[model samples]
Target chain A: MTDADLSRFSINQETVKQWSLPELVEGCGKAGVARVGLWRAPVQEYGVERAARLVREAGLTVTSLCRGGFLTASEPGARAAALDDNRAAIDEAAALATPTLVLVSGGLPAGDRDLRGARERVADALAELAPYARERGVRLAIEPLHPMFASDRCVVSTLGQALDLAERFPVEEVGVVVDTYHVWWDDTAAARIARAGAAGPGGGRIAAFQLADWVTPLPAGVLLGRGQLGDGSVDLRRFRELVDAAGYDGPVEVEIFNEGLWARDGAEVLAEVVERYAAHAL
Target chain B: MTDADLSRFSINQETVKQWSLPELVEGCGKAGVARVGLWRAPVQEYGVERAARLVREAGLTVTSLCRGGFLTASEPGARAAALDDNRAAIDEAAALATPTLVLVSGGLPAGDRDLRGARERVADALAELAPYARERGVRLAIEPLHPMFASDRCVVSTLGQALDLAERFPVEEVGVVVDTYHVWWDDTAAARIARAGAAGPGGGRIAAFQLADWVTPLPAGVLLGRGQLGDGSVDLRRFRELVDAAGYDGPVEVEIFNEGLWARDGAEVLAEVVERYAAHAL
Candidate 1:
């Protein structure tokens, strides 16, 4: 494959959530994928040092860490704990040599109606974590989830809102992650991607481009029904074209959260993901 | 009951979806609700003249028509047919004496990825029909649905987006319908309501205020499943206060679409609805 193809692909670990860290690395490497996005739980389970070694041994790049946010809750202690955990996550991402760490700003604090205040707290947490992330040469990528998740998942529910947060933080350390599954339905996506892309490298703009498809009859809890490439309604090629037009030439990471995909053999899923990505997203 | 109290409540026909039009009218009268919203199918089934006479006989007011939008489609012929039907719906709303005709901007055209264009088509249709509605003394109220319906239902999914459309037409002829179930989760709801309120009576803002509770574990094909007041997580009183703060003292129409509620006896549902409105909404 050409170097251009290598620069345009990455695999978010969620696409094969059932696999162990080493198995995921081996599978992705064999599939000709250059980069893998790691989720914190898996990294922690395998131990960060071992996970880092496995990734290195497999010659696979760690594109970005899956998460480091949920810094909002009624209890001050829980919020503080999230921040502490996020700091460790930043350290782990740095160790893995991942340049970006994604953050899904948590939902409304239980028993509270202060959405605006929760958003402020997210900004504050990002501000506090920015310096450490920058010192480690890692960038924070804020992901704006779909509005359906506004209540219990992420309060930052629009591309514009995520961009606002990115703009408020230090550009050297903070950026935005554009996931098609979440923001594809947004009317302002094209314009927002263009604006983010114009911000340039390390300028706190589009740090990662994650892919998944939109499907109907969202499952219970409304969080785990994400479709694999070509399995649902979203046109990933058009989305890729839009991001490319906006000057974002980053790796297109596949991040499905479907139970069916999760239950399959890791290698089989990885192979299908690579084939689907090339067919529907490239 | 005092005149002010009577004036503060409206019943959306869907609250008693299991009831026939005459039964709904009788129940509204028995409950002493001043106004009622009607769905097109019920109006068509009962015949417009009979429905109007029932409302007049019951001493109940027709607050707004339940719906008259879904103009977007794959074929031009289908769109034209929808527009023709909308015209007939406007005539029926006029015959029923409802002052406002609600619109649910339809979803993406089949095989079409242009959401922005679908939205523009909705605006264009509204513009085309505004004069007809104005002539019939029926104001058009664009109801912004929740984003979950962005794919198969309405494209106008936020108050801001609805207001943007409202701005495209003459304010006196077109306005926004603020449904709590749809817009309650929006982050900018308060600000949008404030903006709507600031645009005075003739400015076509806050033409209707709908109430319903949001419930989780939303059942599949969730076209129905609204929660009863105080039954879910939505803080109805807060929303009522917000709209009131925005200078909207209009009827708080209860528009529940729950299958569970629909199965109960019509009068029983109406009685519960009235109690919930008083205890939870006000």
Candidate 2:
């Protein structure tokens, strides 16, 4: 495939979760994929500086970081630890030279029936972290997971809500991740995307645009059931066009979490993703 | 439980799906539960007229009918048949003396990415059915399934979206169902609940109030994973309070769909549900 074909395509680390950091860098280099989204655990495992050097030497840009937010913990000790870890994550993103650190705001605390209160805590946590992230040249991207994850994974469940939270800070410090699997069901998402992209001090909150299809019969726990690009009901092309119209000329990172895909060969999955991006996303 | 304690309680049929119509009637009678929500399939299996007579003789009021929607079909023939089926469902609700006929609007037609078109088709189907339903003294209740079911089961995924659709028709003709399981995750649900219960022609669209809990490690398919009241993270009492504050004093129906609950003896399950309702939802 031509480099131009994959100019905007980025393989999120979780999408090819079987690959080691070295293997990921080597594979992307060989496959002519110039961009990747890395996760914190593996980066830390391989030593963040070394891993960052490996990607740089391989001529692959770190498009974004997998995550840095579980900011819904209510306990003082746990909350403090969470913020410290997030600060570390922000540092890791800067070290990796990625512009964005995606955040999946944690869901309700155990026995906590106050969803509003949990969400408010997320806002409070962001208020603390945004300035820290900005100082390190990393944008904190608030991702609104599907509502099914609202109780256990992330309380932020819509683009509008993400923007509402992100708009509380400067666009440079905070932003939103528009993942098709998470926000595709909202009829108002297109309008919200336009709002996020509108020009102003508060606009351009589209920090990272990620792609994953919403397939059903979501596996038990519903965590790793994201479908491959063309295998599910999401209109990937429409989302791409929407982001394009909204002036987000950024990497379209593929971030499926399917066990089936993970079981396949990493290079094979990467190649298939490139082909899928061309056929479905463009 | 005393008569006053169980005053607003309604046992939805699916919660004790293993029970026969006769068993349900006898069981509710023995438990002093005055209200029951009926499902079309079981009512039809027992003969609609006979089931209606049985519940009536048992001194039970039918709070609402289980469902009467799949109204997003695109094929002309399928669309006509779906409308016909919904009409029969409305007639059955009327026969059973239930004012509300729940409509789970169908998702996109196969391989169709147009969610807006599919939802528009639901509005079209409702336009045709609302008058027929009003003539029979039935309010067509648009029930928004959680977004996880947006691809295959229902496109209506929020109270706001349901209200948007329901507002097009007269309040007596169209309304929305407030089920805690489906809507507990939405940050805007409480505000929308207040809107649904406001006074006037545009308001008071809450035709049904159902309760179920949100549990984690959702089972495959995610359909039968609804938790028993007090068994999961939902703020059942708060939802009840919200509805109460919004001027809705309707039947509080318990509608769980867990495999474990279904495996138990129907009477035992009903008694447990009653106990949990008292503890969690009152």
Candidate 3:
């Protein structure tokens, strides 16, 4: 227990998706875990202000808000609505006092095959939003989902591409999430993570670091195939080391999206997450 | 039908996995298809000499052999066994008078996570086998599987990585396979194809061009999720143009692994493949 400092450990609510905001906050507080990463739906459902006060009262930190960007909509009306939604998300993050708002760049627009066009639109949307994020003291964290999701989820499929987009804005206003499950397969990830931290304007640039393993025979549809730590092929500890080497001293959020994990009790899942994080991600 | 010449079209038998060697050759001959790509097991089962004679008698061109490399085995005994297998595949290609042998670099060694190590060994194996392939008048084509297969199936995940490895050997001895199903999501694929053909010591060095579309709700295992032509997101026509622009005028082989397509009658599947190839791949 001498080196078991869980200060930087956090649980993303999606890992225990069935848990309510209040229960999650109370659970983390009781477990001596200091931080929780929240999703937009539950917070809005529970009332963002109440959720914020609940966590504030429980002395639990809000590591990050689930998402804010789907800015690749091609239709003018839909695109405008996405931006408006992102604005609201940023405001919610501000209300929750979370320093980072995760952004999953929208996939290709329906009936649209232009991936490059979609990625470019994400950059343009960021330019519009970075000032807002900066004004609120929140960094927009662009999450680079795996290439498997390139067509349907997030077009920012590599850490190098995420940094390419993140660099266009100030480091303080925008940054990248080095989620183990997403960027693990990337050959250049270690170097890119290093560059993300060192090459940014003032250094210390990684906004959020997440942990999720990758297991094969990916479940049908593949979205819920994220493996629990130590259950798959990814060298999770190495990723932790890489981010640490890049001088990123921040919350390492556990973010699994597997059906099996989601089927379990929240406290039980949180206990195993902490154990695996210490063993596989430390 | 004036412009519907299929002189450069070939169907890998796995596209009709239910068909036998003699039946496949006869089916291609019946369909007015001149070229056919082949797999190792069925060829061996039918006897290489017999299969070669059968295709030759049927006036069918053997474009390429299915595969010859799984050189990432770390155990000395297993590694030696894989090489022996690949060497035999090359000898079979030579006997069949096939112009190319496709290579699928194996996945990570069992219980091992060093992907870079496995990839480097693929290079080592290629260096050993390239001269043997060249001496047999057969070129080895490195097929880069999609990034999704980076862990459990194939470590060579992108066209760029394939070209990087193939360029280390002579152009005639080694070349790259441009498979749309495997590489459609890659952002730099078009550029990589151009480099593959134009930058080799010998110009126009692409050894094989494979076509398969991508579909969603990928089945349980995800391996058999390849869509039928004109059935998914990939712009197969644009890929054909990219390969054409790269100066590849060789056989455009249709190699799909799908449950639904495999369940249909082989002749019916072949007919539909021809129609779809003309529409989506021309």
Candidate number achieving the greatest DockQ relative to the actual structure: 2
TM-score of 2: 0.97
For candidate 2, what is the DockQ-based docking class? high
Which regions of candidate 1 fall more than 4 Å away from where they truly are? Answer: A1-4, A200-203, A231-235, A263-268, B1-6, B231-235, B245-247
Clashing pairs in 2: none
Best by TM-score: 2
True contacts kept of each: 0.26, 0.89, 0.60
i-RMS for every candidate: 2.2, 0.8, 1.2
Model 1 lDDT, residue A146, Cα: 86
- Please estimate how well model 2 matches the true structure, expressed as its whole-model Cα lDDT: 0.91
Candidate 3: C-alpha RMSD to true structure equals 1.9
Chain B TM-score (model 1 vs. true structure): 0.95
Model 2 lDDT at residue B216: 94
TM-scores for every candidate against the unseen true structure: 0.92, 0.97, 0.96
lDDT, candidate 3, at A189: 89
DockQ of each: 0.45, 0.86, 0.71
Q: Summarize candidate 1's per-residue lDDT along A206-252 as a digit string, tens digits.
A: 88889998777777666887887886667788888877887776778
Model 2 lDDT tens row, A132-201: 9999999999999999999898999999899989998988889999999999999889999999989444
